[model samples]
Target chain A: MDLQKMMDLPGALAAFTYSDKGDLQSHVLREGTELTPQVLDLLAHSCVANQAIASMEARGWEALTGQSGFQPLKGFSMVGLEWSVVVDGNCGVVVKNRDADYEATFNALQAA
Target chain B: MHIVKQLMAIPGVVAAGEYAYRGDRFSYEGALTDEFARMASILCRANTLSVNMQSEIFDSFAENIGCRPVQGWIVRGSQITICAVGNYFAFIENRDELLNDVMTIMRAKVGDVQDDLLVNLYARLGGDTKEALY
Candidate 1:
């Protein structure tokens, strides 16, 4: 599915897709959103990196508890002063408002 | 340790800990076992790394336009919330919906101790420290 469809969600400022290797695959920013390409690239990479780290941490937890299998990390949401960024699988969406319902928006984006 | 205890006293905070930049748990309070504490530390450290990377990228881009880096960040999960405060990071595993309140209490208790924690972390790491803490 095209990640850009996330832009349809209210308050979504931008949507992006990236590989596990941090390579940007696609990106869409709302019109008049004054963000640079470098910033978008960085957000994408950070989202992917956050997922990688969370996965590692989850594995560590499973090892510590002797649980053979633990659910994989879905993504992470970082609440910044001005925006909230959420990443699921290989796709990320940035919402302009910090209080936006990122989890719901992310779910809708994935379900699209 | 005192700050950790205070954090644990907050409503909805199931576990609380103080961790170094490299995922070492210096002190913690709550129902977590030692192994779980270590895992929590690693998770919190990873959260901090993500925040730092994002800050760096935003700062670099902002610098070009006469702006500043982000001061801090909050990462919310299903049952956990991690907040980065300078060199040290603190997190609360909570089931209640008072994440902001928990973060506020954590920052109030541990915010000023960032330098002290960094020094202690440096001492524990045999003088090795991240340049950002300097």
Candidate 2:
């Protein structure tokens, strides 16, 4: 997803692209935002770990329950005290919790 | 009046329960079989740990950034979604406003989670964290 598009997301303070291993490749931060490159880098790395672990859970859940619809995982979101980060594949966007639309954020991540 | 029972009372809640830090002991109610419940327990533990680690890492980068002391997390799938607050986990079928309702209720019940993931979870289970290895 284009960094601009990600930035356009409601409450979005930043958008970034990360490596499969969670290294932050590039990022765009909104003006006057407290988020720094260092913070975004750490956030990217965490996103990778969390997403991978979530995928594993999804697979195990399907196998154990004999259920479908959870596989091919769309995305993952970590709800923080004041904000949330939504990510899919290698793209992620961080939005303020007050303005976050989790459903929309997930949809955007998948759409990207 | 159990949290699991409260969650199970929701219309679209398929399963709700509490899992131990090790993911070995769990108690739940809903449509899942014994094996499925076990898997869910492990799933919740894994996710909880993952998010907790992430939150701690974020705090290390910058303190009081509002990402620390992680509250919880959600995995939104195509039709099924799993929401976790503290040691409690809920599996719900996606529907109109159901996710928000369940989340609100769970947050209200579980309240805000502490920063120490191991201590936070172990305290709820009445276990000693000092001797336990992460």
Best by DockQ: 2
Give the C-alpha lDDT of model 2: 0.82
Scored against the native two-chain complex, candidate 1 gets a DockQ of 0.22
Which candidate achieves the best TM-score against the true structure?
Answer: 2
lDDT of model 1, residue B93: 51
**How good is the docking of model 2, as DockQ?**
0.66
Screening candidate 1 with a backbone cut-off below 3 angstroms (N, C-alpha, C), the clashing residue pairs are none
Candidate 2 chain A, poorest ten consecutive residues by summed lDDT: A97-106
Candidate 1: stretches off by over 4 Å:
A2-5, A8-10, A67-70, A109-112, B1-13, B20-25, B61-134
Q: Please, what's the RMSD in Å of model 1?
A: 5.4
lDDT of candidate 1 over A1-112, digit per residue (tens): 5656688766788888778777777888878766666776777777777767666665666677764323444456665545667777777777764345544664665565
On lDDT, the leading prediction is 2
- lDDT (Cα, tens digit) per residue for candidate 2, span B1-134: 78889999989999898887677778889988877888788778877787877777778778888887777888888889888888898989878778768877887898788767777777656756767645
Looking at candidate 2 chain B, the ten consecutive residues that score lowest on lDDT are B125-134
TM-score of chain A of each: 0.82, 0.94
Could you tell me which 10 consecutive residues in candidate 1 chain A have the lowest summed lDDT? A66-75
